[model samples]
Target: MRNALLAISLIAVFAFFLYVAVNPGDFGGNTGDHLIFGEPKYSDMDDYFIHNGQNQTGANNIVTSIVFDYRGFDTLGEASVLFTAVLGVGVALRLLRRDKNDE
Candidate 1:
């Protein structure tokens, strides 16, 4: 009975997510408006980045300028997360090896 209840709840949650994914509402716009899937919404920020990114960052490549200068903090956070995951896996492997040697 508990397993059946859990399965039903999971299915409900999945359905909710699927519905949301299919019908994502327009961002920063009026209610009841929907955005087409995979279509990018143009904003002032995008225009500014395209026009001024290279001048501001002195990077020849726009993508490099955005990643290294415009979004530095976000890039840092991603690198930190990747480092932490690698450290965690290394520690887990060491602990498992130590347990094997003890037996």
Candidate 2:
């Protein structure tokens, strides 16, 4: 069980790295704070797919499909991470609270 858990952890890490390497976070160009990310002239191909996606490809909720399809595994991992963080926060909050009598 321990080995299985460790292997999965490693695989998840590797998969994250592999996806990042393939999908350039910025297409070797400027993706700065000033950019709105969907400006027609400045946008990357990904932005085009996201903006005009639903109409172009006849798919509804383009953002949802993008989040779960092309980047499905990554998004899943990120969601798992957020869930773990929230769970930890809840557990910590519960532990930190004092009972009325204790206080």
Candidate 2, residues 1-103, lDDT tens digits: the string is: 9679989999999999999899856544546655435544555876778777786556688777677665779998999999999999998778667543378
Go through the candidates in order and give the C-alpha RMSD of each one to the true structure. Answer: 6.5, 12.4
In the range 17-77, model 1's lDDT, one tens digit per residue, is: 9999999766656444445454566789988989998879999988899899988999999
27, model 2: CA deviation in Å?
21
* Worst-scoring 10-residue span by lDDT in model 1: 30-39
- Off by more than 4 A, model 2: 1-58, 98-103
Return the lDDT, model 1, position 85. Answer: 100
TM value for model 1: 0.64
lDDT against the true structure, per candidate, is 0.88, 0.76
Clashing pairs in 1: none
